[model samples]
Target: MKIIISEIPKEGLDVKLKEKVESENISSTVIAQLRIEKLEIEVIVSGDLAAEVKLECSRCLKDFNSKLMIPVNVVYHPVEELKGEDNYEVRHEELDMDFYSGEELNLSNLLKEQLMLNMPMKPLCADLCKGICPVCGKDLNIDKCTCTITKTDPRFEGLKKLLK
Candidate 1:
């Protein structure tokens, strides 16, 4: 889904897409409703990207699906601005800025990036997941394990005596 920069009309372009993204990060089909506006050489792409992402629980290690709707608000600058060796600092507004080369703006890549950014760093099936038992290797949520576990750091031995 590439939007040619030169072909954009003065009234802007509206695009509605439902396609599976070809990326390692995204596993499910994505639906995007985007409005592309051109202000001089800069392109502003704003829309909502909807997708169902398959995620694995960090604690229980169970696979689950999460539905996400990420709001797209990105300003694309010419790739030539990224050239030269001049040192620069990025401002707060520039956080949403991206660089594009040539007349094509790949919306698929944009959707992939937005989806990745919106995904959780650590996915959990539930907040109070019991997780798997460390010693007996049994799912604590499903079954109980009779494994006496004691963990006391050597440095905390003196502190244990004080509590007693």
Candidate 2:
């Protein structure tokens, strides 16, 4: 979704879109609300994006729903503005800053970046989940296993005698 800078006129552009994003283990359906305020050749995008993603719980591997909110601010300039400089630093006034080769902005790429940034590294359903048992693969939280819990080290036998 690229918007031509010249087409924006003097006021600004307001846009809202609904899109779907697919990743390795998750698929997110998102709604993006955008407001573009132009400053000379540069445009500032300020908006809120919300999405619902399905993720697997790290402990029990159960699928769960996760909600994501992405707030975006980006400054875009014409490619001519960056002709002489190879390295440039983004300022506080700038967000999602980019220089375009043409008159249109590539909105799809920008949206993809925002979605990737919002994904969680490790998703958990609960903090204190008792994971599956290593031997029988039973859920430790639901039932007790018949396997005996024992310390196997012979070196600890002397310490065990001391306790007695």
Top-TM-score candidate index? 1
| Full-model lDDT for every candidate | 0.84, 0.77
The top-ranked prediction according to lDDT is 1
Cα error, candidate 2, residue 12 (Å)? 1.5
Error of 1 at 22 (Å): 3.5
Q: Which ten residues in a row have the lowest lDDT in candidate 2?
A: 144-153
**Model 2: CA > 4 A from native:** 23-26, 134-136, 141-164
Clashing pairs in 1: none
Which tens-of-lDDT digit does each residue in 1-164 have in candidate 2?
A: 77877888678889898877776755788889999888877877889889898877777677778888999887877778777888965664545676677778877666777888878887876677776777777777677564423434677868867998
TM-score of each: 0.80, 0.74
Model 2 clashing-pair count: 2
